[model samples]
Target: MLQILNEEGEVVNEKAMPDLSDDELKELMRRMVYTRIWDQRALSLNRQGRLGFYAPVAGQEASMLASEFAMEDEDWLLPSYRDIPQLVFHGLPLTKAFLYSRGHFMGGQIPEGVNALMPQIIIAAQCTQCAGIALGLKKRGKKNVAFTYFGDGATSQGDFYEGLNFAGAYQAPAVFISQNNRFAISVPVEKQTASKTLAQKSVAAGIRGIQVDGMDPLAVYAATKEARENAVNGEGPTLIETLTYRYGPHTTAGDDPTRYRTEELDNEWEKKDPLIRFRKFLENKGLWSKEEEEKTVEQAKDDIKAALKEADNTPKQKVTDLIKIMSETLPYNLQEQLEEYTEKESK
Candidate 1:
């Protein structure tokens, strides 16, 4: 239960604050603002059929930003599809992100030195992959750690247990971050697990586990930074359960929450929005002004609009190109089939 800011956004743990310069804090706030704007715009795009399905990180901005900021450049990140903000914070281009949303195959081909994996849609798959990567790094005597992100529901999958157990047993350099947003597609966390907390589950796997206040960015950063340090220092893996909430649907094209949840509860969560909480924290420090806040949000909106336009202008991919991209050396039978298809098309 680590926390820096309380529910009212007052500094409750001054010692936990990062040694950040005013410029850095301002920049972080800018990124948060931009990320929120991008998320909303993407959701709108999906609704308008301009893009494919999207997972909104509307209520979890602090959790994403802090965890991302805690990582090193050389470290690897295995993120679930919902972690768009984490990818953006790690220097992924906005154009590529939009391209991915538009269903482009090459959009996820991350550039070198980025050390981020493609977003995994299969639940809990990236956890095992991260464990393997961390194990390999450990064998190679590398200092880098691997951080894998997943939701609360993913913990029920076999891969989650297998990955965590193996990482602990072999002393793999990895961190497992469980962003417990309470609902796994309408299934509450309590119904998903009998355990009192997700972090407690890690104890059975023989790893250090901590439950952090996810809405508090500084708390998340402190927890992840410590976990990362322990991994790099040969102390093996750690599990961090970030208690947070999602204020939107599971994905843009998913079922409406009103079918399963109360609008009153939704409104309550809205009042506890991480962005607003952090904004108040900054204001209390005299680090944010009303005019500056307006200007920041306006700039973010402009940037997002520009990025969306760029995504729209990009050349559309041909449906036939999928087959061409799939094979390097086509078998004789496949070659004959392709030739027959091409001949029929020419007719």
Candidate 2:
């Protein structure tokens, strides 16, 4: 496994560290703090029955943010539902995230200039889509690359293989990141695959493969930076398996993790929490301080509140708009249904 920082928050590989400016480090930390606040606020909204459903991104901060930090604004980002932080990092507004979880129709719209798709709700669906997007970029001779995020369980899906296989054969400019959080809801990683490492799955596709400590932002940043460079240079796709953990239930809906794993196990991972280690690293560099962290926390809270208020202000989802976004010119039969639903709901 590639590890740049040890569990005790010490850098063990300065030679392999990512070339991140001090300002970028602070930005990365701010994004992680912002994500945590969003997760907590989302839970509160869900419990109050104000939001439909949500998947928390609390524990996978380094796994999500650092890799995305490697991408350019022109690159394409494909994501699963829990990848809201990366999507927001790519250009989606914080308020749009709340709108999305609340099921507002406009939430699905990608903001202009953000080269990303709406978060895929299906497992591993974005993997194949990412490959296709990358292939398109290659055919068009674009300098941009494509990146997608999936989980450990998704490795079991057919889309994962199909995407990788095609990307390899065509030498597409793509990066596949699998955040192996150790569980596919209830099924443990040991039971999910017999392979020694998820990254090795790329061997069948003839691409670069790497396994890294997902809890280490520096490591993820370095690995993804290398992968992105390889892709834009026509070296082909890379499969990166990030060994990480999720601290919360799969979704905010009714699910009990205690029935599947031990609280002691979760506590163990907490000691290596991404934020704590990265915070310590920045503090030691005199780039971060205790008071600075508190200010970040307060700023996150206020921003989250404003986002929630914006979501609350959005017009409720309409039957017409939902159907129309699916097509510019509605099909003949569906047009009637849309009219009926809109008439009924509008009343």
lDDT of 2 by residue, 1-347 (tens): 99998877789998998888999999888888778877887888899998877987778999999999999999999999899889988999988988888788678889999999998989999999999999999999999999999999999999999999999999999999999999868899999899999999999999999999999999999999999999999999999999998888888878788889898999999998999989888888889887877888899899888888888888877777778777888898789889899799877
Question: Please, what is the whole-model Cα lDDT of each candidate in the order they appear?
Answer: 0.85, 0.91
Superposed model 1: Cα runs more than 4 Å off: 331-347
Q: Which lDDT value does model 2 have at 307?
A: 83
- How many clashing pairs in candidate 1? 0
Best by TM-score: 2
Over 4 Å off, model 2: none
TM-score of 1: 0.93
TM-score quality measure for candidate 2: 0.97
